[model samples]
Target: MEATPGASVATAIRLISRDKAAAASSTCGPGLASPPWAFDGAALPQYGPGASAADPAPAATPRQGALPSEYLEASDEELEARISAAKSGLGDRVVILGHFYQRDEVVRHADFVGDSFQLAQAAASRPEAEAIVFCGVHFMAETADLLSGPEQAVLLPNLAAGCSMADMADIDSVEECWEQLEAVFRGRETAGAAPVIPVTYMNSSAALKAFCGRHGGIVCTSSNAAAVLAWAFERGQRVLFFPDQHLGRNTAKAMGIPLEAMPMWNPRLPLGGNTEEQLRHSRVLLWNGFCSVHKRFTTDQITAARQQFPGVRVIVHPECPMPVVDAADESGSTDYIRKAIEAAEPGSTFAVGTEINMVRRLAAAHPEHTIFCLDPVICPCSTMYRIHPGYLAWVLEGLVRGEQHNRITVPDDVAAPARTALERMLAVRP
Candidate 1:
């Protein structure tokens, strides 16, 4: 029998690891066992069982309560039927928003599926939805809540499904970094412009978004990072971009910001490990954070793909390292990759450097082309895979009984400012 997309990816990895030592030991990390709920009660920080298993989960990452045995032990068939029936019962009362990085199992049930910002916009689009079931990570759900009506509760199927990359730049650390930067720039005001502007990536926490808003800064998605940076440059002398350093660096570099002007800020270090002069001269101060999944893509992978499939077009996410982005034929956001494949001529071969789930699904959807992940390892995002059918069943069943499980609610204080930053981002045309 064929396995579900969620389970099959892991199964494929286990089988491949038997012969291919490089794949098993690759940076993308080998897959883990069944029942992701096993890690629900884990004390140590962890993303449970998936590609990000090798990536260290921050100590502050949220943990989920043990799932009830009924849902945990129920067969896949039962969970699927229950979820379907529950959605049928809920009708227009709920809108399911699935992220592109999510497993195919959960994504099949999404009323609207897209990237984080797209899903948040979807949440806002459905005014009638009493609940927004975000089949994504914690930050994504928080975003949906911020954008959705106050009456509409946003529910995350699995509480443990939190983005590791987002957690890299916590609010406290960011505030500290901000204060240190202010101290360095205190006396060197550039007439009308502020010394630095805060720009939080969409993957960051809501508090960080609010921090940006309060600081006269803005929030940016990967697709609009360049445009947002341009907006920021008009308002401030320099940009302090957080959460995903690769996105900031790549976007700035593409806009003609030199490597010397873009400095990586290690938050743990005083002055972000920069001299006062370097900080003053910096055009973009990048936070030392990255997506574990995107970091797995290497220029070596691009080289191998080009050699193996001579005419293949290579496209990667800007979140990938600068070297990998430079090596690829093209680099853009997930939506860009999807659209590229959809518009390609039949029989076009392409190598995608994003999450393996998206690449695999795109490949299966567009059978005319040969589409594959640059990394040979089966790489479903660790947090994304956490929202399997079981959690979906649990959340939907609770909703069926008029109870909101794992609801994400941002306080009015944070929501207001965060929404401002988000609206500013919306105002900028990519």
Candidate 2:
């Protein structure tokens, strides 16, 4: 994965960033009407760091086209019947991949259910399927599109199902941040220090993944972030992490990297709002992005859970803020949290800090163990919740009719490099 020093890296960054920024900000976005799989955060729920749901529900999709009235008005039984019929008709041609955060109604229909990376791997494993119905957020669908065969179409049930945290670090902003870093570390590699390596989380857009690939960088998921960082350090003097500050901080901190060695990069400000000296001395440059659902978890909830369920083992996602992660008994990815609960003693109690849907489902599945979400408020991923069962029925029915609706396709130019980055990730033995 080591990239030689060259001008193409800088040139590619500038060109790709401009093109992606223009496309991303283009109008007539996704949803009921608009173009298929277009990203318009306006229609998405507000649930990022420092964001509150009290704000009016942003337009959930383009106003130009509305979901067909038939889908919305269909009775639950009718919708289920239609979904079952569509699946039967399509037979093995289609594969439904669901994220753990999906509602029970939609999840029950998925042929395979798992986390983001797991779902992507599942899609890759099923080369026989001509279509992949990804029941997850926009970036996840994009990942599936990149990983699956070119002939295989990837459909996102709800085009408006976009992640707010992923939107925070657009290709343009990341490129600008990189330019600032280059200015700070001028000729450092020539002076014996290796150049900084760009590391994006799996939750980012395909364009971001391509950016990493083009720049000789690699992508990391929650489960393998520590290993990815270790890989980065061996080849580079520093790492630039994005779209989730909490995960970057927590992972680096766990690796014994001091807090002062990790500086947050604010794209809105000049020089990422950090001094030249700070950027030089930093081991990890964290982007000012965070998950809304994970941020809702607090240390107080941990205390309350402990007080109520005495000896309850508290586990949380690394996406949570540092104090919350520090207070928890263990912090890992969603799959890690699930495995811990499944492996615990039958009568053991647990308090989990993650998306509410997954937590509630776990509680329901393992009645012998007392499991509850740390956040008393039902704060599911508002964006993930956009994948209603109604949308699933509509898309499946479309497939039955030989109509391609909301298919997520990454352009070949972008997919090539993005796939390289992902392949490098898979090669890492973490």
Q: Highest TM-score among the candidates is held by which one?
A: 1
TM-score: model 2 vs. ground truth? 0.87
Per-residue lDDT of model 1, residues 1-430, tens digit only: 2334434464555455555565555425544545678787777979976656766887777788888899988986898899999999999998999988887777889999899989999999999999999999999999999988888999998888998889889999999999998888887767788899999999989999999989999999888899999999998999999999999999999999999999999988998898989988899999999998899899999999999999999999999999999999999988888999999999999999999878878987888899889997666788998888999988898998999999899999999999999899989998
Q: Which pairs clash in the backbone of model 1? A: none
Q: Write the per-residue lDDT of candidate 2 for residues 273-382, one digit (tens) a residue.
A: 88988998999999998887798899999999989988999999999999999999999999999999999889999999998668877887888898878986444575
Winning model by lDDT: 1
Any idea what lDDT model 2 has?
Answer: 0.80
Which pairs clash (backbone N, Cα, C closer than 3 Å) in model 2?
Answer: 33-65, 43-59, 43-60
TM-score against native, each model? 0.95, 0.87
RMSD (Cα, Å) for all candidates, in order, is 2.4, 12.3
